[model samples]
Target: MTERVVVDPITRIEGHLRIEAQMNGKQIDAAYSSGTMVRGIELIMQGRDPRDAWAYAQRICGVCTLVHGIASVRAVEDALDYEIPPNAQLIRNLMIAAQYVHDHVMHFYHLHALDWVDVVSALQADPKATAELAQSLSNWPKASAGYFADTQKRLKTFVEAGQLGIFAKAYWGHPAYKLPPEANLMAVSHYLEALEWQRDVVKLHAVFGGKNPHPMFLVGGTPNPIDLDSDSAVNASRLALVQTIIDKMRTFVDQVYVPDTLAVAGFYKDWFYRGEGLGNFLVFGDFPSAEAGTNLRDPGSWWIPPGAIVDRNLNEVQEVDMRADAEIQEFVAHSWYDYEDGNDKGLHPWKGETKFDYQGRGGPDTPYKQLNVDDGYSWLKSPRWKGKPMEVGPLARVLVLYAKGDEATRALVDDTLGKLGADKRALFSTLGRTAARTLETKLIADKMQSWMDSLMANIKAGNTRTFNETLWEPSSWPSEAKGVGFMEAPRGGLAHYIVIKDEKIDNYQAVVPSTWNAGPRDPQNQAGAYEAALADNHELHDPKQPVEILRTIHSFDPCIACAVHLTDEDGEEMLQVKVR
Candidate 1:
């Protein structure tokens, strides 16, 4: 009899997942990554105003919800042909920059660090020796005895404060977690500090967006008023504080992010050589300029290995391949849908339908190899990147942007490489992706500051009208307007397609970062980004210790909240699948 190994309630992610690995002898023959639960945000968006979609979309994922808000608004605005003002663009850019910096720091230190560094190990490190190791990297954040002492006090408080989720049953002394105790203590101290920093940086989103974990924004323009009646002046004092935060963040990134990554890399050097999933990447560009159709930092020229991997041809990508729609379509073939088109053939999501039936694949032998409809594994529909499995996330975006090679991006990249003691050859691995994010944040931060200054100049020059009145009548919307808004979110390329009728959302479709990273097998039966990375000969010492897998996956920073929704009884997935 064939044996099955299952990993349920996958930890260190935003949602619930179950991994079923079919082990043949000592190797994994096949693996199925299943999202255990469903949340239907799409179906619930059905009669809602297009502008309101941003509010609901942002709720898709708590961690990267701002991206959802941005993408949703961009989509609606794209459909309506609305042009936001220059000042509004700068504000959006700044907010996005803040999110990128805050998220990257928090992700590296708190979420992903536990895999490599042991907390308990910190108790044994000589603070002096650890400080020495930290010193070699650059400006070392003081790892003196006093710092470690304070770290111990903070960790103890964490334990006492009953907020141990950050350190839940941590494998502090595990073999894989091989950091010096002092180094560990230093990292731990910053871990607490990063929490506060993240909270502070997220406020940038709050100022523009009503709140985070989902923020309110406008399609035609920003919600914050900016006319003579509105008192929207740049708070120089507050802006100075933000500037200070950016500076401190730059120091932390230089001292802590780079150094910690390197320190951890010394032990986990294997990741550099492995987990290079798909090699093909797509970053649809990010942070559009004040002028429409003018790419300030062209994503077409990325720093990473560039080009789409459909059919395995490596070429510079200037535009989206319209042909991708010709071959790829989401499959309910194995889904609970009983409708004709559920498994019939490829159809665009706007025209896609869902139906439910629990009969499995339908054949004499089908029952043995069929998917259950009653309680399906995931609410997410499988999205095929060019009719094949592909990955999208930090790595993909960085690579795509690097390949495009905008002057600003390349210059920033070179300076960052100089800092990391790396060359172009090293840009294709996990370490490269990790290091690139921090560098990108700094570049984006500095650029945001420049953009803010430019905005103020434009305002002083007496130009405050940032929105165009493009209100189209429902009847005047033409036969059908099919438009796509492509943006680079914190994870990677985010896209939205909208088809409207009678001032109502007829069909609204999105391909989120997770849809690219965590997708299942397509018609070609290829491995997804995560699957391909996991397939790279993992040295599975313990089934419970999926640390390596966590590192590879977290490197992508998969966001499932916006990408999933369940179908109805006939196997048609619902658009709005909630956590509760």
Candidate 2:
């Protein structure tokens, strides 16, 4: 076995992730991605009442708060063939669209932007030059020398105080950071603004779902019902508040987030050449039309069409069926679990198992060392679409839309490519992945106004319905019913599979976006997207600091749930990650 480079619990992301790579001198030969934690949310979901399953399943990840809850309820609704009303559908669409806007913007500025923008470098920038850079990009009101100078002063204080705060533990002053000092200063100022912007933007979720971060969800449709006069319900005041929040979200995304992304990508044009992994993409279409609910299985009814693109071919779009047993499968061969039949055999989510089978390796008390890369070293199962590793997330969704010849997606993709003076092939790299997320944010944020208007129109038309009472009771369900609820999450495709037996959840499994992008190798030795992207380029200029790895992995916006605190026999904090 050759010695490899390891980054245990890669920082500046949502969860704990360890990356080990076998290096061919300066470049990576083979790379490995480990979850470094176990998620038993699927196991905990068994035997619970199907109606209450969303509460437990949504707790899977605080970062992806409402996606799990929405998926969980959709699974049960699909099983009973419950059709929600038009008003309910519009409300749900608003929530989902708001999630895309809020999450994508936050990921760009707070989570992923630091990979390109150097805060330390911002201190050396001329505030006037930074103002010029900002004003040239957009007419955002915050573009002023005084604003940037104040931000630079804050950075200096952070450095002088010997505590970097949110800017700590990063690869500051690294050669990989190519953004000019003025650009860095401008980006840093927006970074601080985004932190406050997200706080105000997330209120849209609270208006309909009752609260943010795992908001209330009903199995049939939506929790908040439209009543123009009632304060307890989604009244006129709450509706106005939601509208204001959506406008704020769009303003930030249009003026600050999108401009900053294009600016950062300009300096890292080399990233547009590499970071292509597997080249197989998947997306379960989301934001379905209320009329499409008549047959919820049709992808044509969805705003974002569901399809698969293989080997970087854009002309041929392969149809994806979440209901087919042969379509979506998970392998535990390279994971910590064991399938009763065979480890290598692929099992659909309906029959997926959550058996913990860590055999005497990397235990809590075991002396820590290198991961067993040749064997199971991660808790995440390798999810495949029809026996192939598929990359899911922003990049996949954009390519699928562009291949389907969506006019809006094409205009954005073509415009971004033109601005960078590159071809369509540039969309397959790390910069492309990050840029796609920003474009998708614009597409969704802009469309949210239409949804809000439709909801108001429904109420004025005397159609103030939210939840469907037809299948609210478990007694209405069949003795045994299995269904899959899928959507294009902020990160990528997310789904929750549920098997109901006698009104109880017999089996439940949620294959999140992070699992599809961050899982380890399969039995056939096919690498997941993370491993494949790391080997695409020698982003590792120095062995000690691998900013390239963070840039690529963070582009996926990894949400491997949250991290578990590890400690010695004495109770004390072992690790602490500064969250912005």
Candidate 3:
């Protein structure tokens, strides 16, 4: 066996992930991805009330707070065949769109930018030149030389204090970094600006859902009661605040997020050739029309159409049927669980099981330095659509929308590709994944305005109803029912499958985006998206630094916490890193 390079607890993102690569000299020949923590959320929901499932499920991950909540409510609604009000549909669209814009910008600036922008390099940058560079990109008002100088001073203070703070533990001076000092400085400034910008944008969630980070959700519709005349409810003042936030979101996305992506991408154009994984994509589709009882399966009315694209063939998009047992199934062949049919067989979420069977190199008494990759390597089960692993998230959703011939999506994608002097094939690589996120942010942000306008117009026309009380009580549902609630979450296709028996959750399973992308090898010995992308033409410049590995993995914006977290037997703090 060849010596493998291991990157345990890959940092700078949500959740814990371990990557082990089998190296052939300087090139990566193979790789294994492992989700070290076990997720028993499905099992935890057993025997719980179906209506209260969203609250517990929303606790899945603090980073992806509202997605699970939304999915949970939709699952219950789907099971009962309950339809929400038109105003409620538009409100949900606006909230989901806000989440897209907010989450994408946060990921790009705070989580993923440090992979490309060297904070240490910014120290050597000329403030005047950085100002000029920033001005050339966008008409953002903070492009003055003095603004750049102030940012540099703050950075210098952090560096001189013998601590990089949030910039600590980064591979700053690595040879893989391609950005110039000036570009790095400009990016750093925007990074700080984004921190403040997000604080204001998240207020939109508070206005509607009552709070941010696991916003309140009702089964039939949104929690907020609509009453334009009532100040306590979603009144005129609250509606105006949402509009203001949407405008700010549009401005920041156009000026900071989109431009920064293009500028940084210009330096790493070579990335356009690597990190293409599986070549198959899946999106559940979200953002329904502002019509009462709008069908979610109809792609024509969806803002971001849902479908599965195989082998990067944009010409033919396969419709994704969430209820088909064979279409979307999870295999525990390489996961730390056992299925009743044995490890070789795949089980749909409606029939999913979470039986713990940890078979590592060592038992619970002792820890193994490396995982038993040949047996079960991860807690995340390999999810496949019709027996093929599919990449999800921004890349999948963007491609599906573009392939479906959405005029706005087509123009945005074509214009961006033309500016980069790249073709559609580039959309399959690491740079493509990153660029797709920015493009989706723009599309969602622009659509937010229309949603807001529609909402206000409805209010003026005396349609202020937000909730549908027809099936609000569990007594109105059938004794036994099963359904899947899915959406195009910021990370990718997020779905929650629920089986209700006697108004209680009989069984529950959540197939999140990260699981689709970062799962272990399946029963067929097929590598997941992360493993395949890492093995495809990835050369290690410095085995110790491993910035290249981080670049490709971080491009997916891996959120392992979506699946589980790490903790010791005694519940002591195992890993700790300070963040300002």
Candidate 4:
């Protein structure tokens, strides 16, 4: 017998997602992932100047603050065939690397940690034992018995006030929560600590880009100028502060974030056995060598190489060509969008269209239940690489690195598996996904010092140029051009494609990371990453509170992560969230 289940507002913050899973008795038979909210950012870029695309595109998400801006600027630069100064490239590398470290750490502790760490279970823990467990994992300074006691006390107060998620009514006592009381207490404490650590880490963005959450960017370079004597520009003291922030990031990721992930994984060893959706992975590469005349297309020169691993075949890594229209395409068959051509065939971003077609998607006679395995259910288009669904993000990047015989990455993977007491085949599951994010964070954090030293050395050598003025004029006369700006965002590979005509944006398409992982099924009936992962190895302990579902979904660290709208079957508003 098969049953259907609906989970709306799958994320807790800025997104509107709905998941419907078909259950065969106790296990999920099939699952459908949907985005209820429309993304009109691409259409918004229709008539803007190509140089200004980054500013408008950066607002596409409430999180991943600076990724869109980076992609936007890169798109314009690629179209112009402009070469930025080495200093400018160095600045961008530092900023992008900092984003990886800051975002991964924040996601691990604030957003993803709660899925594994039981807050209510912590109150039952003895503070001293929690401290002992914490000390055994890492040498972080805050792991004192008294420190845990204070955190426990604060938590108890919140519980007594009936304010701590209504005292664990938020799946606190669920049977699937396997962490011991002491471990749970330790996790909860770091969750609180991470909140503070993130504040200092993002200051690096402010120094270079002028602010966090949509940091400034330019078509050929970053916004900040290198003026050693000026107080307002990226001066000596500011650069020193950047190093401090990088150190702070390395310390926390090493002591708190990495240890916490491994510790949590030890308890959920079974999760490492499943959730390998699509068996394919993709990475678009970022952080190119900050040297003059470096070939951007060469994977060997990139810090994060661009490549595709299809069918988990580690030996044969397929090359990714972003400029090839046939290689990467987005399908709208099951999405709430239209195309000049039929929806069955996918359109590459260069020729992508975003006309919202809600004719049969909603309004009266709309069966809310029909979203279960139906067409035009989601607002996200299914993006495919060479006509197949692929998973992207830290796991994909790590797997690509390991497969390409990167020794540092191989060691990290082996050490992680050794600590967990499991083999490497475990790298293709839910637990492995989470661990990959942590490992990637450590790798990026360690690499930040190199970028910082390069920037410092360049400044000392009197190469303080942070922008190229050669291609600043629109009349330099390439009346028409098109290009792709791609990056390895914390979530996965993100790219912004732009078509320029008469120096204005003729068409713009942003194939974001979330769209790649959280999109709906294609006409070929290939399930997206979320659907395939959920349908693989999950059983419900309680249909009412689907903690199991959250465990797997949260593992992806979704960007459409949200504030939900609960309406009646008749389309009547039941719950409204307003900002007043």
Cα displacement (angstroms), candidate 2, residue 486, comes to 0.7
Candidate number of the best lDDT: 3
lDDT of 1: 0.62
Per-residue lDDT of candidate 4, residues 1-580 (tens digit): 2567788877553477788878887688888888877667776788778888888788788787688888888888888887788888888888888988888887777777777778988999999999999999999999999999999999999988888752244677888889999999999889888888998999999999999878999877778898989988999899889989988999999999899998999999998987777789999998888884224555577888899998888998899999898889999998877887799989999999988665344445545554735557777899999999999999999999999898889999999999889987788888899999999999989988998898898889888998877766788849899988898998999999999999889999999888899999999889999999998788887887787788788888888722234434344545754322
- Better-scoring candidate (TM-score), 1 or 3: 3
Off by over 4 Å in 3: 292-294, 361-367, 562-580
Could you give candidate 3's per-residue lDDT for residues 1-580 as a string of tens digits? 5767889889987888999888999899999999877776787788999888899898788788888888988898888787889888898888888999999999999889998999989999999999999999999999998999999999999999978988898887888889999999999999999999999999999999999988899888889888878878988888889989999999999998999999999999999999996899998898888784536555567777779999899999998899998899999998878898789999999999988776664345434666667788887899999999989999998999899898999999999999999999999999899999999999999988898898889889988888886755677678999988888889999999999999899999999999999999998999999999999879999888888899899999999855433446333435543212
Q: TM-score for each prediction? A: 0.85, 0.95, 0.96, 0.95
Cα lDDT of model 3 overall?
0.88
| lDDT of every model, 2 decimals | 0.62, 0.85, 0.88, 0.84
Better of 2 and 4 by TM-score: 2
TM-score of 4: 0.95
- CA shift at 496, candidate 3, in angstroms? 0.6
Question: TM-score order of candidates, best first?
Answer: 3, 2, 4, 1
Worst 10 residues of 1 by lDDT: 294-303
For each candidate in turn, give its C-alpha RMSD to the true structure in angstroms: 4.6, 3.7, 3.4, 3.2
